[model samples]
Target: MKYDVAVIGAGPAGAMASKYAALNGAKTLLIEEHASIGSPVQCTGLISKAALTECEISEGSFVLAKMKGAFVYSPGGEELTIRGKDVKAYVIDRKLFDRELVGRSIDTGADLMLKTRFMGLHHGRISVLSSGERKDIHADIVIGADGIMGSVGRAAGLPRCKKFLSGIQFEAPYDACDAQFVEIFTGNKFAPGFFAWAVPFGRMARIGLAKNAGDRPALHYLEELIKHPVLASRYRGSRTEHVVGGIPLGAPERTVKDNVMLVGDAAGQVKPTSGGGVYMGAVCAKIAGEVAARAARKEMDIKEYEKKWRSAVGRELALGMIIHKSLGKLSDENLNEFISFLNRPGMSECITEYGDMDHPSVLLKEMLKGADKMRLVRLLGVAFKTLF
Candidate 1:
């Protein structure tokens, strides 16, 4: 089959790209290797309210719970509460959510191809294995929304993300302090270079953590997490579902090469601080789709996708990387001090008003404006120098 644009991967990013491509008059094809979408779920399913708006979807059957705040625990077990006046995020069922997105793409005139595995891209020809048979589909432009492994990008000889955090999680029955608030745990002993979390929905919680601990598998940390006093107190000792995956950070120097463009995880579009890619991926996918459609018609260069997407979210991602690196470097004692500083009088109010899951730089910038700025600077180490 031949199409104007062929988008590989049917995740949120691929679905959005195909939808925009079709809406822009391109004959778009959305390809997925799996027989279905959203299978083998790798995400925590926690997404911000702004993510839904970015994806252009209303609250649907996929939303399982609404979150209004978070309870952060320092290495010393100190609690810092950040309460939002309104719903800030949602816990969703990724299967239903992904299907909804792909359905939108189909409705927008994009063709869906299931059980089609992208073999490679060669000489302007798209190759795939479908129904145990090799086939070739022609397309003027290719958009890769594949995951962190970036199969499509690799085939096109693109550089991969600079770093990857090993992540593991399980869904289990848990007694949460408050269903409307997620719980965050921080310390080198547990997560090492990253953090752990318990995102609750109803009586169940997705408990997991991502860490930069080299050589030691994430499962090692997962075992430590469940034994923590906070988690052990609430965990029912039985898990219903488990997820293990890698979260990529640090986008490569280039995301576009020739007629090919990369978006979403393939392009390292995830937020470094949160390991959340949906919001940023959706933002970039729209640009990739539009640019692919135009490039197919010779109205634009494929490079425009790179420029447009970066202009939109590059600075935010860069700043998030700074914060992630800064936090990852802190010793347990320093972390305790940092969290303590945030727990100071009037500090909770400042955090509650400025804390944003999507754009952490805003909160950091605001913190620098406060009188205790020097304290925070000392806590962040040398990374603070590069943040601004």
Candidate 2:
């Protein structure tokens, strides 16, 4: 098969890229390795209102819950309630969400190929194993939205994401203080180098943790997470579904080479602080699609994709990385103090005004303006030095 632009993977990024490519006049094809899209779900499925806008979808059957606030717990078990003015995020069914995205891509003139595994690149063509048969497809521009462990970036010789956070979660019956509020738990014994969370949906919640702890696997942290007084009280000691995944944290130095470019997890377009990829991935995927379409017509350089995407989100991603690093290094004592500070008068108001799930740097900047500089110094240690 031949095409003007070929996008690998049928996830949100790949689907969006192919859709935009076709929308911009490029003949496009989107391929998925799985027989069905979004079969084995991996995400915690919590996304900001901005993420939904980026995906161009409104509340649908995929939206299982609407979150209006969060209740954060310190290591010492101090509680901090942050209430938003209105709904701030959503808990989604990823299987339905992904299918909707791919369906949109197909509606926009992008061809779909299921059960196609990308093998490698050959002589400017893509080699794939489709339905137990090896074949090659010709395309002028290739967009790699295949994910972190994907082959497209490797075949293109592009560098990988800086690091990965190990994540584990399970769905279970829950006792939620407020169905509209998500709960955040932080401390060393529970989730060293990261944090744990319980995102509620009516009487159920997605309980999970992500960590940089190497010796202690995600499962180790999970075992302790469920034992927390808050979790133990809410959890019914039973789980219906479990998920394990690695979340890439930072973008590589480069994401484009010759006729190829990377997007989504393959290019590490995820938020370091939140480990969410959909928002950033959708932003970059549109750029990749537009640039790839132009490049296919010999009217633009693929490097334009890199330049534009970075310009759009580079500062946000970089600042988020700085915050993630500082937070990861904090000791239990430090976390208690940090959460305490955030719980202070006026702090919750600031959070309600400025907290953005997709753009945390905005809140950080706003907080630094009102915060006592000396107090910040004591909390963050050396990693805090990079922020200012």
RMSD of model 1 against the true structure? 1.6
Q: Per-residue error at 388 for model 1, in Å?
A: 17
Q: What is the C-alpha RMSD, rounded to one decimal, of candidate 2?
A: 1.6
* Error at 106, model 2, angstroms: 0.5
**Backbone steric clashes in candidate 1, count:** 0
- Candidate 2 lDDT at 50 equals 91
The sequence of per-residue lDDT tens digits that candidate 2 reaches over residues 253-280 is: 9999888999999999999888899999
Candidate 1's C-alpha runs over 4 A off are 382-388
Give per-residue CA lDDT, model 1, range 1-388, as digits (tens).
Answer: 7899999999999999999999999999999999989997999999999999999999999999999999999989999999998999999999999999999999999999999999999888899998788999998999999888799899999999999998999999999989999999999878998899999999999999999764578888889888888989999899999899999999999999988999999999999998999999999999999999999999998999989999999999998887888778777887888889999987888888998999998898898999988877777754464344
CA-lDDT, candidates in order: 0.92, 0.90
- Extract clashing residue pairs from model 2: none
Please report the candidate that would top lDDT against the real structure.
1
